[model samples]
Target: MRRFRPYLRGEGLILTGGMTALIAATIMKLLEPWPLKFVVDSVLRVEQPTDVATVIGLCAGALIAITALRAVFQFLATTVFSMVGGRVLTRVRSDLFAHVQRLSADFHEKSRAGDITLRLVGDVGMLKDTAVTATLPLLGNVLVLTGMIGIMLWLDWRLALVALVPLPLLWLATRRVTTRIGQASRAQRKREGAIAATAGEALAGMRAIQALGLEGAVSRMFRGANDRSLTDGIRAARLSAALERMVDAMVGIATAAILWFGAHAVISGRLTPGELLVFLTYLKNTFRPVREYAKYSGRLAKAAAAGDRVFDLLDQVPTIRDRPGATEAPAFRGQITFHDVHFAYDGGGAVLAGLDLTIPAGQRVAVTGPSGIGKSTLLTLLLRLRDPSGGRVVIDGTDIASVTLASLRRQISFVAQEPLLFSAPIAENIALGAGRDVTRAEIEDAARLADAHDFIAALPMGYDTVVAERGANFSAGQRQRLAIARAALRHAPLLMMDEPTAGLDSASEEAVARAIDALSADRTTLLVTHNLALAARMDRIIVLHDGRLAEDGSHAALLAKGGRYAALWRLQQGGRVRDAATG
Candidate 1:
C-alpha cells in the first residue's frame, strides 16, 4: 500500500465519484424487489380492483425505471474504476523502467535481463486486472452486502437468521482455500518468470546455439521450466474452481433453508407473502458479494504475488547514486591520478592493490599487462563504472565521485573493442556522443580524420547507409574506423581505446592503426593494448603486473632500463640480438 501511495496521490475525486455511483446502484438494486412485491400483494391480490390494467401498468413502469437507473450507475462506476486503474498503471510502468535504468552496473551484472523484462511487462500487467476486477469490485460489493443484509434483518429477523446460517462456514472454507492459492500463485508467477528468461536467452543466443550444436540442451532446459509453470497454473485453477463450487453449495443451502422456514410463516399469517418474497430476494442479493469473493480469489492471490515482486524491484536502491551536495564537474584538463586506489569485487581478492599513478594533461600513455592483471579495471575506474574500495580517482584535481557521473563521462571519449553500433544511418552513428547535435560537415570532417570517409562515400547511400547489427554489414576495420570517427566527433579532452586494432587481419589492422594514430594526436589518450608496436608509439608506456605498477617511462627509457617493460617487449618481438643490445 505504501508503494502504491505515490501513484494514487490525486485519485480522490475519481474514487468519490465511483463510490457515489456504487451507493446509487445498490439503492436501485434494493428497490428492484419492492415493485414486484407491490404488484403481487396489492394489484394482483385485490378481490375488488377499480382499475386492474392501470395498477399493473404503473407497477411495471416503476420496475423498469429502477432497473434502468441501476444499469446507468453501474456503467458509470465500472468506467471510472477502469479509467483510474489504466492511468495509474501507465505511470507505474514508466517509473519502473526509469528506476531500472538508474540502477548501477553491479546490479545488472548479477541480474538477468529477461527476468527484469518480465517484471516490467508481465508483473505490472497483473496489477491492471487486479485494480479493476478484484480490488474495486470487492470493495464495492462489501458495501452493497452490508446494506442488503441490514434490510434483510429488518424485514424478518427469524428468516434472516436462517439465511445467514451457512455464511460463517463459507467464510472459513474460502479463507483456507485462498491462502493455499496464494502460495501456489506466487510459485506459479516465479516459474513463469523463469520460463520467460529461458526463452529470451535462447532467442538472443540462437546463433551461438546453432554454431555449437546445443539446441537440444537449450530446448530441454526450457521444457523443464515450461512444464513446472503449467503444472502450477493448473493446480491454482483447480483450487479456484473448488472454492467456486463450495460457494455455490452454500448459496443453495441458504436458499433452501429460507424457503422452507419462510413459507410456514406466511401460511400461518405471521408474515405477508409480499414480505416473504422481499426477504428471499434480499437473501439472494446479499450472497452476490460472497460468490464474487469466491470467484475472484485466485485472481486476487495472483495479483498480490505480482505486487510483491513489483514493489520488491522498486524497493531496490541503486548502489551508485549522487550524494547530497554532489556538484556537476566542470570541463576537465584531462589530468588523471589514482591515489592508493584499492578495489575488490564483493569483498573478494583485490584487483588493484594500493595502486598509484598519475598522467599529465595532453599526454598519450599506453597500458600493457597480461590477462587478469587488471588492465581493464583501470579504465572502468576512470569511467566511474565502479568506485574503488579505498582511495580516490581524481580528474583535474577533483575527486570523480564528488562530481556528477554525466559530467565526468561527457569529457571522455571511449572506443571499446568490438565497438557497439546501433542500426541507424552511418551519419547518426558517427554523431552519437555526449552532445549528439552535429552538423553534416562536422560528421564528414570526423570521418575523414579517422580515414573512414573514402569507404563510406563508396557505399550506395554514403553517410545515409543504415548499419546492420553492430555494423556487421561492414568489415572489422570499417567498424573500428567508424568508432574512431564517433570519438573524433565528440572531440572530448580525454580518449580511451581498448585494443582498437585487435582481432583484425593485416589490412584491417593497418587501416585501424592509421585511424588510431590520427585520433590520438594532441589528445589526452589512455590506450590499453597488447600490441608492442602500438605501445612503442605512445608518449609513455605503463606496465601492470600482479595488480601493481611494474614500469612507467618513455619506450626508449624503459628499454634502456631493461626492466619488466623491456622483457615484455622483447618476448613479443621474439627478442632479436639487435634489440638485446639496447636492453
Candidate 2:
C-alpha cells in the first residue's frame, strides 16, 4: 500500500468512484436473491388455474429490472478499477526506472542488473490483480456477508447456525495456505531471478560462448533453471488444489444440513414447499460467494508475497546521495588534488593509501596499473561515481563531496572501456539521456571530433541507421568511437578515458588514439590503461600497485625509477616484440 501511495494520489477521484460503484452493485445483488424468494413463494403458491399468467408476469418483470440495475454498477466498477490499477502499475515502473538512472555506479557494481530487473518487471506487476479484481470485491463482500447473515437469521436462526459450522475450519485453512504460499512464492521469485541472470549473462557474452564451444554447457544450465522453476510451480499448485478441495467438502456439508432441516419442516407442514424452496436458494446464494472467496485466497497470498518483494526494493535508499543543502558547483579551473585519499571496494585494505597528488589545469594524467589494482576505481571517484572511504577528492580547489552530484558530474565526461548503447538509431543513442533540443549539427560535430564521422557517413543510413539491441551491429571499435563521440559532445572541462584501445586491432587502435587526442584537446584528462606506449604520450602517469600509489611522474621519470611501472613495461614490450619475431 505504501508503494501505491504515489499512484493513489494521482487517481484519487477514480478510485473513490470505483468504491462507490461496488457498494451500489453489492446492494443490488443482495436484492436479486430476495426477489427469487418472492417469485417462488408468491407465484407458485397459488392454485394454478386462477391468475397464474398475471403472477408470472409480475415476478419475471421485477427480476429482470433488478438484475439489469446490478449489471450497470458492475460495469462501472470494473472500468474504474482497471484504470486505477493500470495507472498505479505504470507509476511504480516509472519511479523504479527513474531511481535506477539516478543511482551511483558503485551500486551497479555490487548489484546485478537482472536482480533489479526482476523487482521492476515481475514483482511490481503482481499488484495488478489485487487492485483490478480483489480490492473492491473484498469491501463489497464484507457488506454482502453482513446483510446475508442478517436476512438468514430472520428466516430460520437454527438453519443459519448450522450453515456456518465450517466457517472456523475454512478460516484456519486459509491461514495455513497463505503461510505455505508465501514461502513457496518467495523461493520461486528468487529462482526465477537467478535464471534470468544466467540467461542475461550468457546472451550478453554470446561471442565468448560460441568461441569456447560452450553451447552444451550453457544449454544445460538453462535447462537446470527451467527444472527448478517447474518444481516450485508444481509444489505451489498442489497446495492450492488441496485448499480448493477442502473448501468443496465444506460447501457440500453445509448443503446437506440445509436439506435435512428443510425436510423436517416439510414433514410437520410448518413450512410450505415454495417457502422451503426459496430458503434453499438463499442458502446456495450464501455459500456461492464463500466458495469464490476461498478460491481467490491463493491470488491474495500471491499479491502479498509479491508486494513484499516489490516494497523491499522500493524501500531501499541509495547509499550515496547529495546532502540536503548541497549547491551547484562553480566553473572548474580543471585543477584536481587527491589528499590522503584511501579507498577499498570491500572497505578493508586501502586501494589508495594516504595518496597525495595535484594536477594543474588542462594537464593529462594517466593512471596505469595491473588488473584489479584500482586504476578504474580511481577514475570512478574522480567522476563522482563514488566518494572516497577516507580523505578527499577536490576539483577546482573545492571538495567534491560538498557539491551536488549533478553539479559535480556536469564538469566531467567519461568514456568506458566498453560502450553501452540502446536500441535506437545511432544518432539518438549518441545523444541518449542528454536533454532535449540537441541539434543534428552538434551531433555531427561531436562525431567528427572522435574520428567516427567518416565511418558513420559511409554506413547505409549514416546517423539515422538503426542500432540493434545494445548496438550489436557495430564493431567494438565503432561502438567505442560512438562512446567517445558522446562524451566529446558533452564538452565538459574534464574528460576520463579507460582502456580506449582494448579489444582493438592495430589500425582501430591508431584511429581511437587519434580520436582521444582530439577529444581531450585543452581539457584535463585522467586516463586508465595498461598500454605503456599510450601513457608515454601523456603529460604524466601514476602507477598504482596493490591499491597504493607506487610511482607518479612524467613517463620518463617513472621509467627511470625502474620499479613496478618499468618492470611491467619491460614484460609487455618483450612479449609483443618476441611474438612478432617468432612470426
Which candidate number has the best lDDT?
Answer: 1
- Candidate 2: list runs displaced more than 4 Å: 47-50, 104-106, 133-140, 263-275, 556-567, 576-583
| lDDT tens digits by residue: candidate 1, 460-534 | 999999999768799988999999999999889999999998888767887888888899888889999988778
Point to the candidate with the largest TM-score: 2
Deviation from truth (RMSD, Å), model 1 = 4.1
Which 10-residue window in model 1 sums to the lowest lDDT?
A: 574-583
- TM agreement with the true structure for every prediction: 0.89, 0.93
lDDT tens per residue, model 2, 1-583: 7656766886878878887888888778777765566666666665554676777787778788879988998899888888888887888788878888777666777777776787788777778867667765766677677777777777677777887778777878877885786677667767777887788889888999999999999999989987997787677767777877888888788889878987797678877666566566666666655565555656666677777767766676777789788889999979999888888776556676777778889999899988887888778788777788888999888988888988888878888888888888889977862444588898999899889999999999999999888778988888899999899888688988889888787678888888888988889999999888778878989988866788988888878999888998899899879867986
Instruction: State how far residue 323 of model 2 sits from its true place (Å).
Output: 2.5
Off by over 4 Å in 1: 46-49, 421-432, 435-486, 533-537, 556-583
What Cα-based lDDT does every candidate model obtain?
A: 0.87, 0.80
